[model samples]
Every structure is written in structure tokens, then in C-alpha cells.
Target: MVGFEMNDRRKIGIGLTGFGVLFTFLGIIFFFDKGLLAMGNILFVAGVMLTIGMKSTVSFFLKPRNYKGSILFGAGFCLVIFGWAVVGMIIEAYGFILLFSGFWPTVVVFLYRVPVLGRLLQQPFLMSFFDRFTRTERRVPV
Candidate 1:
């Protein structure tokens, strides 16, 4: 029965994260505007901090195992701020994939719990594709 509880702070965190994503998408769609991209990056990082707590966020970025991703992500943020939006985005995308590789399974599981989309994701082809991401041996630590 253990799961995420919908507390006020978490709710606010989710909202911030959603807004961050929306802004980032809009920024990208607008041909990589530096200001928008910088704002989006700020919001996204803030949202993640709020969502996971300041201590956890710091630890996540500071973890020795995450050095490459953290460095790349930070560099990318700097690049965006310095007006290299396209290159920054490319690096950030790579960093993001590396940093969040562990979360893919949880995302897949969450997707499977949705109503209509759950059914679609349960199909053979989709399941096969998703199963690779949701491996039994690679579970995220609770």
C-alpha cells in the first residue's frame, strides 16, 4: 500500500514541475530563445528541488556517480545563459537522459496505472518496448 501521498507541498511541487515543463516546451518551440530557455531551466531545477527537497536535490547533483551528468547539465545551463541555446539544449538533453535514466521504470509503471492510456500501453509491442525500461533488476531505491 506504500505510495506517494498528495501532500500540500508535493502538490505545489508538482504544479511547479508541470509549469517548468510547459515553459521549457514553449521555449524550445520558439526557436530556442535564450531568455525563455534560461527561465525554463531555472524553473525546472527549482521545481525538482521543491519536489524532492533541497537536501535530496543537492545530494543528487553532488553525488560522485552523477558527476558527468551533473557537470554536463550545469555547463548546459551556463551555455543557455550565455546565449548558446541550441548547443546548450543538446548537452542538457544528454545530461537529462543520463541523470534520469533511473526514473524511466517508475514513469513506465505510473503510465500503466492510467485509465485509457494504461490499456494502450499494455499491448504486446508497447509492452515489449516498455519492459526494457522497466527491468526487474534495475528498480529505483525507495
Candidate 2:
């Protein structure tokens, strides 16, 4: 009964974050022990993104209106993981594009809320670009 009180999303987030940490650790070990630098780096990056996606997804679940970012984050991590098996470079590139597209805006927003850093982020050009890129409304105005 007590365990059941926790929602599914929380469970999922914990699971994903746990696996991501494990994979990241393994990636580091692989790099150090076997010198599989490229593979290790890929695994590490994917794990970090997976953990981030889990956080985003849990956040989205708490506030359903803002679900798109979580979806994109999860999908991006999946794509990056799958890219390891398929076309390698190209798929990874696309995955990274999707990942950044989904993740950067949230980061910008968070940074903008900070005290001192917010001032720096208030610069016109950067804010304009951040607004345009992160806006969920329209990529190209009609």
C-alpha cells in the first residue's frame, strides 16, 4: 500500500535515472580499461540524456500542459541509443539535433531565472534567438 502510493511516472523516472547512472559508470570503466573511447563516450552521453529525459518526463507528468519537451527529450535519447547500432554518425547527428532542440530551451529558461546569470541572458540578440527557437508556437510565422 505504501509503495503503491508512488505514481508510475516517478517509478519510471527512478528506473531510467538509475540505469542511466549505471550505464554512464560502465562507459567510464570501458574507456579506462579497454580504451574503447568512442563507444564509451557515446554510452556516457546517452546515459546522461536518458537521465535528463526522465527528469523532464516526470516534470511533464506533474504538469501535463508542458509535455512536448519531455517527449522530445525521451525520443532524442532513444534515437541516440539506437543510432549506435544503425548508421552511427548520421543517426547520432540527427539524435543530437533533436536532443538539443528539445533540451536547450528548458536550460535557457532555467538560467534566465537565476539572479546574476539572468542579467547576462537578458542580452537582446541572445534573448531574441532563444525566444524564436524555444517558442512552441511557430517555427516559421505564417
Candidate 3:
């Protein structure tokens, strides 16, 4: 049963990656077409979400500690919606960085489980940085 699930996930990831590549190609070919380019970007983001496994990706955003990350993300979206051009892109990049930081623990766990690359996940500095988010402070009752 688990094997079947893993196989399904792999198939989905491959399909999404292929579709993303196709969209990217079409975007390049139709560079003059703004609509197509935008669609390609959307598809590329979708592809990444799928490749990372939707459950894990969604969970990252849904985590309580990561809620603040949404504020930056939303601000970025608003900037883009207002058509701020380059400024919006810059803000969006920062937003993504914050969002990723908020969920770095999940990312670390995933990376640590990988084969060859897993060894790199053991670095003290990296663990310490990511662990900052995983820590919770306790308050004493008066």
C-alpha cells in the first residue's frame, strides 16, 4: 500500500515537472505574449508545489508558527496586484524568503531524509538557524 502511494507521488511529480518544462518552453517561444508568459509563470509555481508534494507544501503554510509569514506573502501579492512592477517583485522575493524561513524546520527534516544530500543537513550552523523557529518559549503564571 505504501509502495503504491510512493509510486503515485513519483508519477505526479514527474508529470508536473514535465508540464512545467513545457509551459516554460511555450513561454519562451511566446515571449511577446504577456498572457502566455503569465500563465507559464503560474504553471511553474504549480509544478514546484506538486513536485514538493502538495501535502507537505500546504502544511508548511498551515503551521501556526508560520502564520506571520503569510503577512509578508500577502503584502507582496498586494504590491503585485497594485502593479508596482520591479518593486513588487523585490517585495515578493523577500516575502518568499520569510515564508521559507518560517517553515525551515520542515524543509530541514525533508532534506535530512534524502540519501546523498542528507549528510549536509547535519551541519551545526544550519541546524541552529532552522532550530530557532522550532523553539517555543514558556511563560510562568503569576
Candidate 4:
């Protein structure tokens, strides 16, 4: 409903569960077929993405970044490595895109701090909202 779409956790959970089922189905399509190893690899990669997407529940409930959280993160990373290796054997470009998608957000904060080529970009006086994210603040409802 409206609430699920409004919240990121629900969005990701639904997306993950939906995609997980899809990939499982896709994996089944080539069940027991040695020739379809490529499809199986794709399924494995999709499963990991799905798993990561659904991890918000644990992270939110237990306070992520704790010891157990570190272990969970390691597991996720290992899944990424295993899945990526499988995916790379099938479609290298798609694998890279998926890998980058998994990691792209980590750079968001620092991304806004990168210096531009032109001297004009260095001046904050004429900076736009997107270019000057340093002063940005949110007023979330409690």
C-alpha cells in the first residue's frame, strides 16, 4: 500500500522477495542441465542482490555495524564474490553493472565533495543546490 512504497525497507523487501522468486524460477528453468550453467550463475547473482535488499530488517532491528553485523556484512560480501564470479562467466557487463550498483551508494557523501575541473565550480557563492550539498538538511517527521 501507500506506506510500503513510502518506506525504503518495505520497498527493498518486496523488491528482494519478488526478484528472489523470479531468479529461483529462472534457475529452475535450467535445472540439472549442465549446458545452462550460465543461467544458474545469473540466478545466484540475483539471489545475492535479493538477499542484500532484504537485510534492512536485521540491520534496523539489531543496530547494524555491531559484531554480528560485521559477520553478516562479511557473508554478504562473500556472496557478492561468489555470485560475481558466476555472473562474470555469463555476462561480464551485466555483472559489473550489478556489482557497481551494489557499491555505488558508498561514494555518495564524498561524491559531492569532489572538485570540478573549472575554477567557477570552486566558488560556493554561485553554487546551485546540487553543487553545494554541504549545507543540506532534512526535516523528517518524528
| lDDT-superior candidate, 3 or 4 | 3
Instruction: Provide the lowest-lDDT 10-residue window in model 3.
Output: 133-142
CA RMSD per model (angstroms): 3.4, 9.7, 8.5, 15.9
- TM-score per candidate, chains pooled: 0.87, 0.38, 0.43, 0.23
Sorting all predicted structures by lDDT, with the top scorer first, yields 1, 3, 2, 4
Off by over 4 Å in 2: 1-46, 49-90, 136-142
For model 2, give the 10-residue run with minimal summed lDDT: 32-41
Off by over 4 Å in 4: 1-9, 32-142
lDDT score for candidate 2 against the true structure: 0.52
Displacement of residue 123 (Cα, Å) in model 1 is: 2.7
Q: Could you tell which candidate, 1 or 4, scores higher by lDDT?
A: 1
| Model 2 lDDT at residue 3 | 39
Residue-by-residue lDDT tens digits, candidate 3, 45-140: 566576666786687767787667756655654554454434544565676787776456556666766898877755887667755654542121
Model 1 per-residue lDDT tens digits across residues 1-142: 2577777877788888888788879889999988888888988888888777899899999999899999999999899989999999999989988888888988998898899999999999999999998878335554
Model 1: C-alpha RMSD to truth?
A: 3.4
Q: Give per-candidate clash totals.
A: 0, 0, 0, 0
Q: List pairs with backbone clashes in candidate 1.
A: none
Q: C-alpha displacement of 64 in model 3, angstroms?
A: 12
Tell me how far the alpha carbon of residue 9 in candidate 1 is from the true structure, in angstroms, after superposition. 2.7
* Tens-place lDDT digits, model 2, residues 16-128: 55665465456446542222323443444444445445565355434554344445444544543554422333344464454446567667777877999989978998789
lDDT (C-alpha, whole model) for all candidates:
0.87, 0.52, 0.58, 0.42
